[model samples]
Structure formats: C-alpha cells, structure tokens
Target: MATIAFASSSSGLLFNKSKETSPRNGASLFHYNGLKPVEAKQFEAKGFISTSVRCKTVKAAVSAPKRETDPKKRVVITGMGLVSVFGSDIDTFYDKLLDGVSGITPIDRFDASEYSVRFAGQIRDFSSTGYIDGKNDRRLDDCWRYCLVAGKRALDDASLTKPVLDTMDKTRVGVLVGSGMGGITAFSSGVEALVQKGYKKITPFFIPYSITNMGSALLAIDTGLMGPNYSISTACATANYCFFSAANHIRRGDADIMVAGGTEAAVTPTGVGGFIACRALSQRNTDPQKASRPWDKNRDGFVIGEGAGVLVMECLEHALKRGANIIAEYLGGAVTCDAHHMTDPRADGLGVSSCISKSLEDAGVSPEEVNYINAHATSTLAGDLAEVNAIKKVFKDTSEIKMNGTKSMTGHGLGAAGGLEAIATIKAINTGWLHPTLNQNDLEGDVTIDTVPNVKKRHQVNVAISNSFGFGGHNSVVVFAPYNL
Candidate 1:
C-alpha cells in the first residue's frame, strides 16, 4: 500500500511526498529513491498535513502558469491597419485616442437632423484610392470597402506586398474580417430601388456586396489568399471573435498568416434609425463629443460609431522565419453568451465575469498579471456599469488594474470596436501609455477601478485584456502581452 501526500496552497494544489508501506511477505519489488521527505512535525507547524514518510521541513514552491513557449503554436501580431474616424493610419488613430480626442460629430453622411440621435462617430471623406479599383469602389458597400483597405494596408505593413507576396505561398494566408451590420448602406439602397423602380432596378451586386461574409471574401480576392476565409457577425464582439478564430487557424496549421479583425460602416440612415428605434443611442446633439461618457452617471446611451480595424496575425515560427516585426503576442482569448437578454447584459455580471476568467485561464495568466483593460464600456446606463461590476468580480484588487473605455472617445464602433480596442491595447503595451476614457465628468460610484478619466496615463503593461460585448449578449475577451523571446 502507498500513501500519496498533497498540500493545498492559496495558489493551487502542491504535491508533496509519497510513502510506501512494507511489502507483504517481506518482498519489495521497487525502490523509489528520488523523493525528498519532509518532517511531519514541521509540516504540522506550517498547517500542511503529512500522510507519508517525512524528514526535514521545506517550504512548498509556488509556480505560476507559463505561457505557450512553443514557437509553432504561439501567435503574434505583426502589423495593424485601421480606417478610423481619427484617420486611416494606426499611429494617428492611437495618438488621437491617447490625447483623449473625441471623434464624434454631427452625422452629416446623411440627413440625421430628423432623428433623435443626430450625431455619431462617423468616418468622413474616406477614400480607398490605393486599395481598390475606382470602378469597384463606386459599387462596393462602405463596410466591404473599409475591410479591403484595412486588410491590404495591414498586409503592406507586414511587408507582404509585391515581391514578398509573390515569393510566399498565398494559399497559406487567410482573411477573417467581420462586420456587425454588414453593408447596411447597400441593403438600404437595394430596398429603396425595389420600392421606387421595382425589381428591374435592383442591381445584380445587391446580394454579393450586402452580406457579412463578403468583406472577408473580397479581401481574399484582392490579396490572392486561399486559406480559411470567413466572417463572424457577433455584433460588437465580431472583431474579437474573428481574431480568436483566425489565430486558431494558424495554431491548427491551417494557415501561416491571417488577416483578421473587424470592419463596420453602419452609420447610414437605416443604421442610425434602427438604434434610435431601440432607444439605444445618445441624444446629446448639443454636444456630440461629450455624448459618449462611459461610467459617467449622466450617460444616456452609447453614441453610434463606424470604422474598420485589421491586424496581421502570424504563427511565431512563421513570423521568425520571415523576420517579421512582432508588435505583440496574442496570448489567448475566450467567448461566452449571457443567454438572458438580447440587447442587454446580465444584471448579475455572471457571463462577463466567467468570460474574463476563462480568457485569463486560456492565456495562461493570472488576475494579478493583468494591469490594463480595454473595456467595451459603450456608455449605456446598464452596459457601462454592468461591465465594471463584471470586471470587479473577476479581479479582486482594483488598485493595480487600470481600465479605459475607447468607446468614450470613438463612440462605440459596433463590430469594429473590438478590433479598434485591440490595437489600442497593444499600443498601450508597446508605448507604456493608456488612453483616457473621455467625458468622464461624474464617475459612477460602482466603478471602483481607475477608469483613466480624461487624460492618458503612462503604464508599463505586463498583460492586457480587451473586452467586447455585443447586442445579442455575446461576450468576448482577448488577452495580449509584450512579445518576449
């Protein structure tokens, strides 16, 4: 008979010594001499029980979870590109965020004067000149157009243009850009044409360009990539879902590189009108910039925003083989659903807390390691505080963790929100700065954590989590950290 000894620590379970009794019939088949014994009296003094042979007391060693060390399985961010209200450049976008610049403005793309919510974070004068042909550009929906531009720019940033692209196996590359209200502009136009001029007036491109998956398909066509190409429409959580899936494709050896993230250009008449119909938008027309105030006591609702954000994700083995510049490491991620409500998160914050815990577990990290959080924080009365509560539930100490809401400045980019925030998270890790949650005049009492209100703070981030929860109760959390050899 053998007795295996185990010790329970605050960290986790710790294995101690195992002792075997005298063999029956005075015959011993095996002699195990590798284990070091601990004195039972010493262990008892330290509150550790000893069920096996003991000698001298020794402190139990505590171990932390190790991140994925295998190069072939590890995922890294190589490049980033975005079409934001601030601009199309990644640096310019992050700079605007860090400065607490508000991108929200009066919705002039269409006549939003009649709507209750008259303002939005709209992208004005956006041109995909170098990325798409003029002819195709004229017909493509803004959602698809933004996806193409962002995806191509990401590839270019990764140095995957012309000669470099030609030398590589295109089949090993993939596109996974997702959108929430996919091609709303195109769909609205098609409906208008059908009602005014009948079926004959409906353009043949209506179906092809209006679907959500078209963005990923179009990017693949333009880039000649033959790997896993698709779109996930999880509302605002679409981008993180795409990132998670794309990284898995690389980790599974289905692809070497993935152009992934989210694109959303839903700031059309219908898009605005729909949110207004649901009473989910801020009606602060007098001051558009101050409308999106996440964690503020006076926040009415989230201000609608639109844009596209893309990242070039590659396996570490493939990235190092090509000498790619690693921006940050995609440690891990997780997705969950509330299943309680359609447009609102659970009041108890169970789903979100569980999702965050799972994300940390998947990332092989601890709550103590996460110092920064890019919150969904869409400024709605329920959503903003619900997320904060959820965060507080997962992270016991709010003192070390600093969280900021990008939607406070950018006004909630819908499907593109997660992608945009992910870039912001990585930038914070890289530059040692965290953007401010703007318009945070009167902070909510429940928000015990530092929300980084109104100004950027210099923070050397160890690990960061970007959160995105969507209208359908979709919850997603992605973990990122600085790349280390």
Candidate 2:
C-alpha cells in the first residue's frame, strides 16, 4: 500500500518525494475514505484536514472521533524503527541474528588503544547524511541524530505522515524517546573543541543537542506533537521504561497517540572509559566478531552497542476508530526495581521476576499464552543468568517457551533494546519466524533455558514478551500479543 500527499495553500508550498501531484499555492483538502493516512503535509496554510488511507495489511494513522472503545482493548504496534550495528529494518536485523552475527568491532570512531575494551558494537556504516541535511546535521548531537533518524524511519515504515495529524488532535500526540546516556559524543567533541580553539569555538547548540530530551523534543516539534512529552534514562532499560510510560499515558487517557523508544550513540571516549572503569564491557579486541556470546559458557562481558528504536503507540479507542493497522497488541507492561543494588540485580532475581509476573497479570494474560520471549540476555555472566532465572520463574509450562536475544545482533542496544526488541517480536509474530540468539553455541552457568540458534525458524507464535533490565536494578517487561480484532 502506497499513498502520498501534496497540499498547497494560498501562501507557500512544500512537498515530499512521495507526492504524486503538485497543487497551486492554495489549501488542498485531503479526504481519506478509510483511515486518513498521509506521509507529509505540504501546504500554504495550516488547518486540520481529515484524509485517510487504509493499509490493507497494516493500519495507518489516527482517524475520526473515536467512538466507544475498551480501556483494556489490546494495543497494537502500527509502526517500528531501529538503528543498530545490524541493518536498520527487521529483515536485515533478523538475518544477522539468525546467523549469529556479532556487532562488536574495534573502536574506529576514536583511538581505543588506551582503553581496556577497545571493541564495541558501534554503528559503523550509517552516513547520517541521507537522514539529516548537512547544515542541520552539525547541530544535532550523535544520540539525537540517531533518535531523529530512527523516529522518522518508524513513521515512514508505518506509512504515516504529518498531514495525518489533522485526523487526530495534535495536543493528544506525545513523544518519549529515552537515551540511556545521551550526548556523550557531544560532550567529548565539545571538550575537544574547547581545548583546540577556546570556549568560543564551541557551538551554542551543544548543551541542547547533548541532553537526551533534545532528541525527543525535536521529534515532537518536528511532527507537531505535544502530549506527555518526557524522556527516561534508566541505562540499559531505558526503552522498556519509555514504552511502559507511554502505555500508561494512553491507558490513562493522557494522550491518544504517542511515540516511544530509545536511542544511544555513546561510542566515545567517556562512554568507553566509563564502562571499562566499571569492568562492564567486553575486552575481546582480537576477536571482536565473537565477543557477545549470550548463553555461552565462555562469555566475558557485554559488547556495547549504539542505536535507537522507536514505536508509535495509540490509545485503543483512537487506534480502533482510525482502523489503524494493528501489527501486535501490547497487552500490558510493568516496571520494578531490586532496591538491592545500584549496579547489579539480586542473585535471586526477585525484582525481575516480580516485574515479569506483574506485567503478565496486568495484561490479564496467562504466562502459558506467551509464545516467544525477547530476553535481556547481554551475555554478561551474572546479568544473563539472572534474567533467565526471572523468566523461568514467571511463566507456566516453561519447557515449551521459545526465547531469543536480539542483542546478539544489535549488540546491547542499551536503552534502545526495549523498543528494538519490540520490532523483532512484531516481525517474529507477523512473519511467523523466531530469530536466533546469535553467538550462542553452548548454554552456560546454572541456566537451563532453551536458546533459539543459528538461523530463522518459522513458528506460529501469538504473544511475545520483551524484557529489559537496566543499571540501578531497574527492570521492565513489555507484553505484545498478535493483533486480533
């Protein structure tokens, strides 16, 4: 399904590459027969216009006044986007996962000769030029740039546009894109710039660009969204927390539509040094490709990955009214903490289990109903087994559980894992295939859970649970079910 918009009002005109026709400098009215969907709003004047496009297989943007709707009605994921060391979309990412690809590569962005862990799962090939114009690109921090591009990709993947904003109230739109440790690149660059040419050499946008919220703020402003805007910074568990917050907003009727995800581009000096200082990163400098071996007996530490993942979430009523494409419904989610430590989870995995259990309970679904689980297995010794213990304790008929760790390919996407894993789960359900937990040749430690390995396998899965446990004992679980009317 392909649809484009070109509206010219009595003033100025803008257009998207997808536009089919050029209208004179006058306001053009767009009328969508099904769910008004547009890519971009290029017009001379600003006024809400209702135009709809119904994606036969997938739903479009928001629509007419939402009539009667169920509060507990399942929430479907209409759109998804990701930017990792792996290729951008589900297809590329899944292929690498099934093939046991490792994102760890030597630190090329900066000379890592002095660091203990020189290899990280850095995004090496992205030009960023295609997504951001050269002039504005310099103004954005690395993390924000990643978020900006990822967010736009998600909207495009969902076949949504700025013109579709007319169907839904702009005030009801929100953005929550958490960056676990945002603008580290900016801080590094700014310091270098300062030392090279004094304080005057630094750009004014440094502060705004470096903060995590700038990415989310810019996203909302760009799309004219203004509902429940905020950012979460729970380290590795950032995206899970953002999605959980966004879901709560929708359920509470704070906003009808929201964009939730996380981004991280912390492949800089401070980032590498900080993690190394904590002894939390992998030191497989010679064999970077085989560094992140989850569930493997010889795994050492996590391979730091850099990327972003964004999901567009709409209120049940709003989505139903628009007949929006429902990819997978987010049944429910929850967040918890161990309160036991600042950096490590309790060996007993009590908080993680409580979060998983409560999330299933909140969604009102049985653990047996969950077919596939996206585990928070970072290949780190203690953390990996702890998450597995948590999952084993939460579900029923646990032996039949099919679990995969997407981080195997994307590297540990840090905060972005929550939403990136969502992309994998949705694709898994939509395509009826389970991506493997890359680099897992042998199971290790006291964990005895099944690990999907080596390639893509087709399986009929209904519900998928994605887990993310961040630093500070933060734990979050998101439940996604097959989109059913």
Using TM-score as the measure, the top candidate is 1
- lDDT by residue (246-328, candidate 1, tens digit) is 98898899999999999998889899888765456777889889998888888777788989999999999999999999999
lDDT of candidate 2 at residue 63, scale 0 to 100: 30
- Tens-digit per-residue lDDT, 1-485, candidate 2: 01221111100011123333325634323221211121221111112232332212121223322212374444567788888787676578766765666676788898888777888888877766556788878777778878888887877666667667756688888899998888887777788899999999997877877787887898887777878898999877889888888888888778877789999887778887876654566667788877777778777677777888899887766776776777778878888887854553454566777888778767766554566788887866556666665666665345556788777766677777777788888788788778777776777745665677756676677567888887667888888877666
Candidate 1: 10-residue stretch with minimal lDDT: 5-14
What stretches of model 2 exceed 4 Å from their correct place?
1-73, 192-202
Report clashes for each candidate as comma-separated counts. 1, 17
lDDT of 2 at 301: 70
Rate residue 271 of model 1 by lDDT.
90
- Model 2 per-residue lDDT at 4: 24
Name the weakest run of 10 consecutive residues (lDDT summed) in model 2. Answer: 5-14
